[model samples]
Target chain A: MILLLACVLWCVAFRCHEWLQSRNRTTFPMPVRAVWLNQGVRALAPCLALALCLMHSPALGVLFWLGLGSVCGVCTSVLMAVLKNKRGRAPAGKPPL
Target chain B: MRDTLRVHMGWLHSWLGFLAGLLLLCIFASGTLAVFDTEITHWMQPEVPLHTRTALTPAALNAAAQAVEASERQGFSTFLSLPSHRDPVLRVLHYDGYEFTGPALSPETGTSFAPRETAGGQFFYNFHFSLRGGDHPGVQLVTFLGLCLLVTLGSGLVIHLKALWPDLVLLRPFGPRPRAWVDAHLIAGVLFLPFILFMAYTGTAIHARVLLPAQSFFSPSPAGPPKKSAPKGRLLQAGPPLPPLAPLITQGRERLHSPDGNLVLFTADDVRIFRSDASGPFLTRDHADFSRKDGHFLRSVTRSSPTVATMQLVRGLHYARYAPLTLRWLYFLSGLAATALAGSGLVVFLMKRRRSSGENAFFRLAEALTLTVITGFPIATLGLFWANRCLPVALTGRIMAEIDLFFTLWTLFAIHALLLCLRRHAAAAWRQHLYCLALAGGMLPLVDLLSGSHPWGDGAMLFVTVDALAFLSGLIALFAAQHLRRPAT
Candidate 1:
């Protein structure tokens, strides 16, 4: 259950990081304060997850955080890509090939 | 200057990644499977009843000790392995060139059962590092490939350094085929960078001695002299009876501060009680040696030196023997991701070159090889399980037969792939192999059910887990095959 929580936190962190990027600003269309908030969450969530994990054992906690972080990152990336595709066609009105 | 550097790095990454990705696929896949080796072995040997919560008896240990002694008297070095949670049957095992093979003894009683000999999961464990080739050449090749993977990863990171962070979560599965492949390669590579780098470095460092013969780094002290071959046509005299192990086990566990002391290695001079690899994060060879004649505790040897501890940590990281179930699953998933990283790189390599060199013979061969590796290995792996079920239980030398079937199936797939490629039907080969893989994986559970060898009682979970994973693999393969039916973008 703690691993699950850590994984979800990692996913949120990755998503926030994705949204805060300058290149994604046009697509995300967030307010400046909201962007700042996302950046804070992106930084704080991972640290919170790491702390939660370290409550277990330092060695295993670190391993779990890294492994879960990578897997959750991939999941978030794939999920975002799917959502982006469903939102519309590619840029310039071109359909996805 | 930066453009030129990127160009050079891109070329190196592409060519080196393609060359090493082929064998690395097999290594990573097999290594992933090896994480569950004991469970897989349990699945393979359904005849051995799972003795969950069964306490280890002195009789069982002595019986296994006797078996080990018998094998040693016959000049084969063997060890007595105590029952553990993952594997509840005490075993007397000897290295049969490829894997440990022996009789399983009841943990409660001293009765021994002859489980049908199959390669079992140890085949994957051995093949992961040794490639089933002996230590020298196989370890050398794998070590070299590990270096290549490191270099390729370095170059790839350099090429993508600019976009690494911003494109961290960029994947477009519905985009152009080439674009999608690129996204997949980059995403998987970047997300799995830590795991891939850790595994490659630790794995290569563990075998660095093979690459550099002059440097001796933390070699463990041998229990005794090197083993001698068994004498032919000679009746060997039995050695002295082993002392009761129950008390010794208690003493050893107390001394080592490890309740998981699960292996008792017998040498001509003494018996060493070794802490289980699952005991902790350190793969320490800390053991208590006892005199063979009297079973009196001689000395406890613990590798506490900084250098030895560091090496053990490296090995433990790579082997993951210390991981719990959840962590083990994480290792397995991360390993699969690494395999996918290599596999996607292979696909991208082929796809990128297909338009320009589709007519070239070398390109065709590369496609055939890639198909053989990516699809062929899973097919053979599933076939091994099939062979375990289909082969007669009473047949002699069935272990060899099972291994033969594994290789034979892979070779035949290679031939099938080559023929398809020669006929300019490389895409068809991919579809066909995926279908075959789907069939092999989808039907594994049914085959296990029908074989009647599976234990549906105490140990059914192991069998169920293997079947479920195989079926899941089949579903993925089936999906891939159906996806391939669409025209190429």
Candidate 2:
């Protein structure tokens, strides 16, 4: 239980730092916001999966957590890619006539 | 100087990676091996016979320790470790007063065993942290290197951010020098940055605990009054000699519940401490439990502990103690990637310099470091393993001597690289360096066999493993060297 809490705390601390750094930047896109939300959910997923495993079976919980973490990594990568591509595709600000 | 988070972090990553890249390479590579330290130890001690017994009883182990203690005056404060079924020897470790620290195993009767110096296991351990030097000298130097790595990793992160999203998933194997370095660094760092960060923080934390204890949040325990470095005169009337260690063996076997636990005896007038552990759910070699230092058969906690469970947990996590096989391998591969990242980062600096400085003094210095560090440390490490296999048992101060051989050869390699780099065909000199590395690595195993060390022996696995690894890594170096042609003037 303590370990789970510790992990949560560590993730929050790291995310908080990132958020603070990004606060003054241009407003984040909707996908980036969704990605951030998913990261928050993902942070607690390990502990939740572990609890579920204890309530159910260890094998199930472990597989679930692994899947969860892998998905989170993949999703974050994808979101970052999409946001970058969207920015690249938008027309540049018009030059003075 | 950009205010953007990505820009700053990218900058931080580059500088940190650049500075600490080489040393971190050694740390991660050597640390990956440290995961198998005990297995390697077993492979190194060919003389110890494997045990047939599946389990050991604590009482029997204590009894054996008692018996051994009755005859020997100095080895009494020993821990009786239950033998693994895979190997048939009972291990007794005496640390209080011995020329060196090691296990004495009873292969036949499971009673008294002789002491011998084993440096191969320790070499890997030290090499991970200190490069075979003592804590103060070696670890301090490495930590300084680690600080540099921290800076490099930070800066590298910043530089990668501009194209990070587009290039993050890219794993281009063939590219120009900078492109390759960037890809290698980004892929490895992004994939394993969490691992590297944790490792760095924990490593620095551990070093701080040892070298800068004043910085520790928890102060040392005040219970056991600090003793003088050298013991003073005779308020210390020694106790009566311990009874035959055979009885303690019986005691340990009963308590430990395994038949394989061997008693290591220490003889003295006083202070007989018997330690043993149980076999059920025995911790794997990678689990870094403090209590396990006494082996599974010994569960008794000491009175004055310095570090807390939280501290231990962080340390264990950093060491990948609880990682399963798949994760362990993943960690190992990530470590190797980090090493390549570091090595390539250093090479990037050199490759960039060749164009800017050409044949000037500035270029020459960069070229020298590239040769010396890029090749020096690995050669020194391989040489140390070779010494462990070939050195005679009777050699005095063998451990220290083995370390000395590592430095001596490393220095020579550095000088050789320096001289070679200055030759007319500097590029060809690299090819030749790779050739020498391959030759030396190839001959190591043959040298071991010639010196009477058998690779297949029960305790001789490290000699073979290290030898094989050297040869394999050398082959990679050979391949890399072939790809390099003279830079277009």
Candidate 3:
């Protein structure tokens, strides 16, 4: 769950407009403070997740976090691609489905 | 200069990746399956009652010891494995050249029951490391392949460094076939980089002794005592009775500072109690030895030296015996991702060359070999399971028969692929193989439901899980086959 949140925060901080647009949502250009806040949270969420995992058990916790984090990141990316293609909204330069 | 370097690196990545990727696919796939070897073994032996959480009784241990002694009398060097959460039966096992095989004793009754002989998942475990070719040649080859994988990964990174992060999450499954394959190769390779790197490095390091033998710094002096010769044959002799194992286990656990003792190895003179691999992430063979005749504690051996401990840690990470259920599943997924990365790289290589090399005999053979390695292996694996169900349980040489069937199926698939490629119908071969995989995988659950031993019994969940995964694989193969029906963009 924490990893999922981290992925979401990352997508938002990176301004994944294609994903957002496909979901009938929009995130207009943010103010400087908002942009920084989004980026900060995006970076911090993974660290927080790591901390929580480490609190469980130091060695195995690190391994678990890395493996789970990789899977979640890929799943998030695949989800974005699927959503964008579903709505027939390929990015400007990329080929359409 | 940068363009030239990138081009050179790309050449290295493509050729080496194609050459080594085939064997690496087998290694990764088998290693992934080996992660669940115990569960698969359990599933294979349906005669064994499920949920048999009977406590490890002293009688059971003694019974297992007796079994070990008997096997020794018959010229087999064996050890006793104590019951654990994963396998709740005392097992007396010996290396049968390919895997450990022996009788399993009931924890409650201290009596033996026959579980039909099959290679079980240990086949995968053995194939993962040795390719079932034994220590000298097979391990050496695998270690070499591991080095090749490392080099290929490095060159690949060099070729893609500029776009690494920018395209980290980019995948276009609906794009042109070659583009989709490249995207898949990149995404899987990048996302699972840590896992594949760790596995490759640790796996190679574990077998360093085979690849780079250590030299002795000091030679034996003429003054040194003569080396003792190995004992003469006493296959029929029983030297000593084993001391009661329960107390020794407790003492060994205390000595090792571990909560559980998992293995007891017996010799003519002494018994050694080993700490369970499940006890921690460091798979130390921390064992406490005791005199067999008197049950007196002799000495405790722990790999406390920095070098040995580091090696143990490396082995532990690769083996992952200490991983919990969830973490193990994570390992499984990561391993599959790594396999996909290799498979996609192979496909991309083929697709990129197809137009230019379509008429080349060697290129056609390469396509055939790729089909055999990627799809043929899974087909054989599924066929092995099916054979396990179909073969009569009481037949002699049943284990050999099952193994032979697995190889036969693989060989037949390779032949089929070769023939089709010779006829210049390699694409049809792909679709046909995928359809076969789909049929086999899709019907696996149904076959189990019909012929499985007590499918709805105590261990129903394990059966269900295996069936579901097979069914899911079948569905994916079906999807891939359907995708192949469309013309190439």
Candidate 4:
């Protein structure tokens, strides 16, 4: 039951994130090349957190996963913004292209 | 007036939550801990020996009641709670027309001993529902704050709606004003919105007895005495002597289909009633909670309304008692997040005031509030528990003494926080305050084990658990202090 709930929450959470980013496209830099490596690493965090917590306390595991997912998502998004700004080839904080 | 209402509600939510957030943070954190108040209480005082439940003989029960009644006749209402496996104490509670006191009565020996007035679990429970004061004004204030919370929640949602993705998928160590606030509010709010709404709505309704249509509906007019109905059946004249209540208890249990059900003998007469209603699940709010009111268990049923039942249901949901362990963990985590949201909101509001913004009256006020309630209250709470352990057992008026200890510590911390805030080093003040919190929290269990009559047995585990949680939280706050010290990257 928890697994199902977690999966559903993850799907909905990702979709919501996508929707919000779509609305504020100007300040956000486009993934210049579909950076799978960074996104994959970010996605692994929640999975690993869940796996580790499953042994000691499954409930704590859920919290760990959720927290890890939230942290990773924020870091990568900020990194994308900073990296794009540094390349100097990026568009000035434009109205969505 | 319409615009004023909108603007005031907006301002009310913003400032109330922003100013009260630190206190509310403590309230929420403590409240979540209160779910297992009794369990925690038992865990805290492990010295109370456990005994197997033997059959309740008429003689033993009668003796217990007689003892309780004698105690009650001194201008206090009294109760005798039967022993259960989880808690071996036969709970006896009485109000001496001025204050409430409870003592544990041993069913095996029919001897009563005053339990320590340690606010351990009840502190969290009482603080949330009644804010450590009695009902009425406290409930009213908390309800008012709940409305403001709703407003803050709505505005925070609006402000964070643009950055919801980063909130979900992002973790930034450094950020600009709006971005950090937006991210903090988004993650905190979205994740805990359901829990917060449930808590606020249910908390408001729990005291519906004092508010709205219920109060107006039930209140008698001041001009006249209540009009009485004509008597029915000559009021049953006089009937049988109280049939040795133990037999009636057995009969009532058989009828109720659950031996676990309790029996109440109203007035020790023929009007004996047995109740075994399911107080376990969704039925908790039912005034017919056969488990709670022993004497009037049956009579209360006819007078109850659907609204009362619905309100109780909300109360149960808000308290999260019937929830399974997994769901409880979810609620606890969500509660912590809610506290974070409230705390972060205050931090954001304070941060927005540039040093040049006229020394920002609001910023100074926020800093003061954060210090007093956020730091001071926890210190006071810790002290109250310490007093429970340290105070001599022969000490009288235990309840008032404990509460006084809490307020005294609170006042002291508030004064200290104010003095520190005056020094114009708000961040450093917070760090120092957190160190004090850590010291007090870390010492509570040790004090309990060392000072109390009871040894540091398995029973003290609750205190240990709470102490550990407090210490971890204090460490987290210390880390936060460090984070605050760094210049914005």
Candidate 5:
């Protein structure tokens, strides 16, 4: 459904954050690539959702985008929790971090 | 530099946002619920059998009119309304003070089902527009508040202009109270800006009739009581029989160019058939009139002027009666977000001044009011639903009793809130009130089940959807209450 797709888009945004945090940063702030990667996904989530909704109805698509935006916040919180847990656990053959 | 426009706008934003946000919170919350007003009414009155969602037939009009006539015999000035997409029940409604509550007549036959007298969904719809104040003041007052809300939003946006987009997605749930609430306010405000603006614009425009009575923005629709030549003497006696409905329906549809249109208005003289211009982007109330006595074609009412048509479009956008189910749900979600936006703004205001005004009596008073209005109103709303089922059916003034319960519960919560603030237990009061909201919302479905309504199995989707929604809201409230369980600083 649209809600799940929206959630996946949101989760994908958070996954970008996970990717950034998991990067091998020699210093505290991390490198430029990781920062862009996180910011890029965060920005793309909304535009992609808007684009998907706009294909259905041009006039009302904006409203749908708003609804999706609201849902994405809640979904991102939920999905981030799952992605965090997955990342927190060590790799399949490795021990816990 | 300290006295620049940004600082002035910030001052305006805080003052205006808090003041307007409180009232807007009530209006927004109730308005969101009012989207499914008919379904709520369906859940409230368990006696009436759910009819299939279909267009109201000509026979439904005859039945609705007959039911109105029966009420008229009792000295009640009544009107008939046929089913529409949002509310697919042909019912006869009579005004009680400023709200309408009456019997649901059968669509196939003219027989009226004597449902329990309750201040049904009309209570919320009426509350949104008039706040129970008649045409003179309530409508205009709500419109003024709406204008204030528009200004408040503008000021808030200007104050946050520099960082609006940069912090747009930021919401720090675990941060300090001010940071979290500021983030909430910002996210809700930025995301739902269009929804809030659209509703405020369209809602104020449609209700502007009260402030400026001369402007005929759309052809004024006659409602409530008969306005023209009907004699007042024999109104209770039912002087004449109604002409056949089928031929008039046919003529009205042919003239208006929509088969789904129905007779929304009827008197001894003229019957009006309302058709939504469905093919367009906006909804409309274009109708054709015919003589009720002989079924003669009277006039075709249309909003043709570009100005009036634009007004009609805004009006349609406000109610959104023409929207398909998906669009309606979309509107409903956006409306909920708007309500949340107003609510979060209130929390932000309270938390921002907490340190400076921690012991100030006026600050305490405002915080108490915020708690009472935001959480207490939902408790009162759920109380209204519960009262309808629990009150003795044979009790005198049962309908009034239900309405009284709503106001009485709200007042009691206000008193409770004020007492909590006086005792310096406002934080405790917030937590307790959230629990009350959780109980009120969570128990709604169970309450319906206990009342033998069968909300889940074998019940109509209207009843099922309402209960499921109430339960979902209850869970949300419970989650928030738990989120605030940590001891207050």
Candidate 6:
């Protein structure tokens, strides 16, 4: 269960931009759809992680895992930004293309 | 009012959050540490031998009851606490007008253990509420700031609500300073909005009881004139007859239907045995009251009522007494994010003003004070740990000495940062203090190992968590110091 949750979370988290970028305006004219999709995955990944915790941990443990998963996702995103920047691949200090 | 609604909300978020942000940082930071206050207290006082998970024996209860009586004769109002999963030592504690001060005992022999006299983790816990001021004044200030936080949070959402979805996972830390800070702040603010709002609301609600006038909350006239209050918690003359605690424990357990019942409060007339609710994950106010005189079962008190249970739940959420280790860590992490939210908001406030308004005295002063509070607090906290490790155990008021070191070091560092800022050495100040934080926080384990009273060599992971966390925190600070802001080009 933990491994499945991790796989799902990592897939949704690291590939979030790809999910966004793949949304061509022709099929999804409203930007809200892409935004909703991004938000859904980000939100769902934590819930999935917490669902896994609920199998073994108590309710509060599940709540903690939920919060932990979200914060870790954000922190990992930040770390990825820095690492990408260090590798000279990030388009920092400029608006998104 | 500002020209536009968004502009006005932005202004409100910046000023209100910035003004209260410093206090919030300390409040939240201290509170984060406080989530593990008891665990940290256990860690700081390493002399109290860890107990195997066992129920309290009747002999142990009698011994602790006698000890309580003896302490009461000395004018201390005492209560007995049985072993639980968190802190396994039996303890007899009294409110010293500041903290739970008393003796910890072994359940087998019921003899007291002499742990070191450090302020322990309660200092952070109390400081989180009152900032070490008298409880009334401190509570009022904290509440007012909490209200301000609510206002700031509301206005911040108004400004950033539109971008919440679009920028859900975007963080560009390597961007230019202002942009990076904005993105970072937005990400934290958006991601932890529920937690931020809940903490601010529930925390204030817990402290908001004082806001009501005494007359409003209580009946001015009761059914009868209040009976002359008995001299409560008084120790009886030696060998005063009392019922054995075993039956009460058994009965309480039978009534509550939870095996892990603990005798929390003891008095001449009655004793209270608290146990976690079977359906609830963590603990709640579910207990059975037993008469101490004859060990007769009194009515059980359960917070299953919606109104009473809700209030108790809010209190539980605030104090986190009900949390297991996992929930406690979640509370701790959310608290750190809340601190960062306050911190990055403050930095962006100054960065925007510095660029647009130019570096005036007010901006420089704010920057210095920000640097002082943000860096100085950790430095001070770590210094307290070092003082705990280094201070002579036999020294009178050794705990006070550790507390004094915290304040002294924090004040000195703040003043130094301020002076350096005045000399236009902001970058240097940040770098120096971050290095100091790394040093103070990193070297704690080695210091603990040298003290020989530590649990590091003893292979107890419970006690070593504190040292391990400090080392990790130090490493983060060292990494941050490496990336200290370059002077504005």
Please name the candidate that would achieve the greatest DockQ relative to the true structure: 1
Clashing pairs in 1: none
DockQ of each candidate, alpha-carbon based: 0.49, 0.05, 0.37, 0.14, 0.14, 0.37
TM-score of 1: 0.94
Model 4 chain B weakest 10-residue run by lDDT = B232-241
Query: How accurate locally is residue B217 in candidate 1, as Cα lDDT from 0 to 100?
Result: 62
Error of 4 at B169 (Å): 4.7
Tell me the tens digit of each residue's lDDT in model 2 across B1-489. Answer: 466766566455545654566567677767867766555555456555443453444445455545444424442344444464433556655442212245554644555444335655545666788864556678887777766666666666665657554443443333244655555556566656666766777777667645555655586667877765423111222234344444444444454343443333322322223332222222211111111122223332323233554465456655654454444555665566666667777776666556667678656655666676667776776777677777786678776777789789878877776676665355766676767677667777777677664435444444566667767877877776766654432
**CA lDDT, candidate 1, residue B223:** 98
**Which residue pairs does candidate 5 place in steric collision?**
B63-B110
Output the TM-score of candidate 3.
0.92
Q: At residue B406, what lDDT does model 4 achieve?
A: 83
lDDT score, candidate 5: 0.72
Best lDDT among the predictions, by candidate number: 1
TM-score, one value per model: 0.94, 0.66, 0.92, 0.73, 0.84, 0.86
Tens-digit lDDT track for model 5 on B1-489? 634988898888889888878878888888887777766777777776665555556777666667766776776666656655555566777766756777777666656667787777778888887777766588888898888888988888888888765444545444455655666677678767877888898898887777677857586677788655533322433435567776777777788776662545655577777774443555666788877677788888766788878887897778766666777776788778788888888887877788789699999999988997788888999899999888876677887899899999999999999999878998789888888888988898778778874435434677778777878878988898887886532
Q: How large is the interface RMSD of each prediction?
A: 3.9, 11.1, 4.4, 7.2, 10.6, 3.7
The CAPRI classification for model 2 reads as incorrect
Per-prediction TM-score, chain B alone: 0.94, 0.74, 0.95, 0.80, 0.89, 0.89
RMSD to native, candidate 6: 4.5
Task: Give the alpha carbon lDDT tens digit for every residue of B154-221 in model 4.
Answer: 66555455554454544323445445564565556765565677676677666655555444666667
Stretches off by above 4 angstroms in model 5 are: A1-55, A77-97, B1-3, B51-61, B72-77, B209-240, B276-281, B394-396, B454-460
Residue B313 in model 4: shift from native, Å? 1.5
Which predicted model would earn the best TM-score? 1
Model 6 lDDT tens row, A1-97? 5634654574466445433633223322447776788867866775676666666565564455556555665766676576556766554545321
- Candidate 1, superposed: residue stretches over 4 Å from native: A89-97, B215-239
lDDT of 3: 0.83
Q: What are the lDDT figures for the candidates, one per model?
A: 0.87, 0.54, 0.83, 0.57, 0.72, 0.75
